[model samples]
Target chain A: MANLILLKEVGEAMNKAAIDAFPNECCGFFFGHEVGEDRVVQEVMPVENSKEGDQRRRFSIDPKAYMDAEKHALAMDMSLLGVYHSHPSHPAIPSEHDLKQAMPWFSYIILSVEKEAVKNTTSWQLDEARKFKNETLKQL
Target chain B: MAQVIIPTPLRKFTNSQARFEAAGNTVQDVLKALSTQHQGLKTHLLDENGELRSFVRVYLGDEDINFLQKGATPIEANSIISIIPAIAGGIV
Candidate 1:
């Protein structure tokens, strides 16, 4: 399986975003290159949690934001490798809803936030059956 | 005919092909042609009622189709359509 190569600063930024969002979930896109089977993240851009209902349990990015992210990635000469989101007060594990909403191509990074601190961070990739399998995270 | 830029997530359905030439005058028509060519991708882009899925975002050049006429948005032979899957998830 291809592992995710996340820059240390990128991980910290995502953790900070998760902390800033607090009880609510934070979401964003990862812009980078795919080196062979590994996804190497070069940049992370945070987006608004546009989910209508309680944001504490769920998060969604507006379609316009997605378009903007694509444009941004193109300008940077990078591809949209995956997404990063926080699970406030929950574990860094893929939920059933995550599996249902996920696409097999992108890596999924989940951060567990409790109170104002980030507790855990994990990456996942969907298998052929559309089920999320733990993806190795290599911090550089 | 419009050139559809397949996002990486849906590339598997297209046999890892990134670009596809589909024939249609509107976003819906082009998507129909695309799905017809790759039947495995239909369920991902459309719902049971054949409506575009909420999580699937279609763009004509730099503009999102929803900002215009949505699936009814018109296109030309040289137009480039991009399919971007909305990135989202949660604890629940």
Candidate 2:
């Protein structure tokens, strides 16, 4: 099982993404360094959602943005640890569609916003069976 | 009797029974038995097409059923099966 840590930086990043995606969905990638006791998220990239016109506001990362993220991750010796997305009116739970598309490795984070303010944040990890399990996040 | 371990989020559908005793020679049969006991659970696990829902996952102990035979995977009377669903949430 992979351990999860959400620093103040992560919380702030999530909030920012939520605010940015107000009328639509906001999406981003998380980059972090593996320190002794925690994975410190050092960078958050606010990217344009490729699926901008969908009513769901669900997004897929742009290929260009994805490539750039991969290059940056390799250079920084960081990993593409998690994905964060904003849910404008829904709760922060993976939908049936989300699970079907998720990779078995990366963590998935969801931020729920009500009236442009963040209501809740949660993170999950896909187990060996592709099922999601709750991950504990400690702020540093 | 086989043991079925239900994840927390799905417990409300199972009447709060974390684990259940079932009888079947295969995973599909066991799950069918479970759904019969708890109405609406099968719908949650399987979509209208009767295929496993994308977000729901099943494990035989530590091994995932997907890598094995899926619903056709054989089960021993004493084996433990677990059901888990993917969860997502954060700031809006």
Candidate 3:
């Protein structure tokens, strides 16, 4: 329950999405089937950012898209593990804004992309105090 | 009039009620009124210029306001409105 096991292809697809949207932030959803004490990811579903402007520094997922992701996960017999976004030319770190917006029981992954290439990536989740704390990632 | 469902995390500002009622024919009007009714909510829901914060998403039932008329989106009597904080973050 404490370890997040990400599939190799899912990470690659996430990196590709980030690279494709270089210079602007890209966002998406990840879902997985639950194993005994492990959440093995199954797929990555990209979502369109609905933020009006400042795509380079900010990102917002369309609420409609969020609902769609839930339905899609349900159809695939997977539970939505969390969401992911790319930070072009930045490190994979969650911000104060992220801390304020995050809800409980969801994982958040951030991919660092620099100059059209993906760099480091990290994942976080909200603790009991509703603060985002780093979580371990096992890339398979 | 419409019923605004405040998300769970924001319920501390709403006396822990899941929702509250405000009178208005449009989403913006109801939101503005709700902010007035809740003293400390003005800043959380709106910026200094009275604009909806970029991280705040308003939904009329299941549809986002952005795809519709935005804040100007009209509301029917007793319609349900949901205010959700937009997910935000990036590379540090």
What CAPRI class is candidate 3? acceptable
The order by descending TM-score is 1, 3, 2
DockQ, cand. 2: 0.04
Off by over 4 Å in 1: B15-18, B47-51, B60-73
lDDT of 3 at B81: 91
Worst 10 residues of 3 chain B by lDDT: B83-92
**TM-score, every prediction:** 0.86, 0.57, 0.67
For candidate 2, write residues B1-92 as lDDT tens digits: 99987644355677756688998998888888888888757767877777778766777877778899999999999998877553332221
* Candidate 2 displacement at residue A86 in angstroms: 0.9
Q: Compute the interface RMSD for each candidate structure.
A: 1.5, 10.2, 4.1
**Going through the candidates in order, what is the number of backbone clashes in each?**
0, 15, 0
lDDT (C-alpha) at residue A90 in model 2: 79
Q: Quick one: ranking by DockQ, best first? A: 1, 3, 2
Runs in model 2 with CA error above 4 Å? Answer: A35-38, B1-92
Best by TM-score: 1
Better of 1 and 2 by DockQ: 1
State the fnat of candidate 1 relative to the true structure.
Answer: 0.73
In candidate 1, position B9 carries an lDDT of 74
Which lDDT tens digits does candidate 1 get at residues A88-113? 98999999889878987789999999
Model 1: CAPRI class: medium
After superposition, which runs of candidate 3 have C-alpha atoms over 4 Å from their true positions? B1-61, B64-85
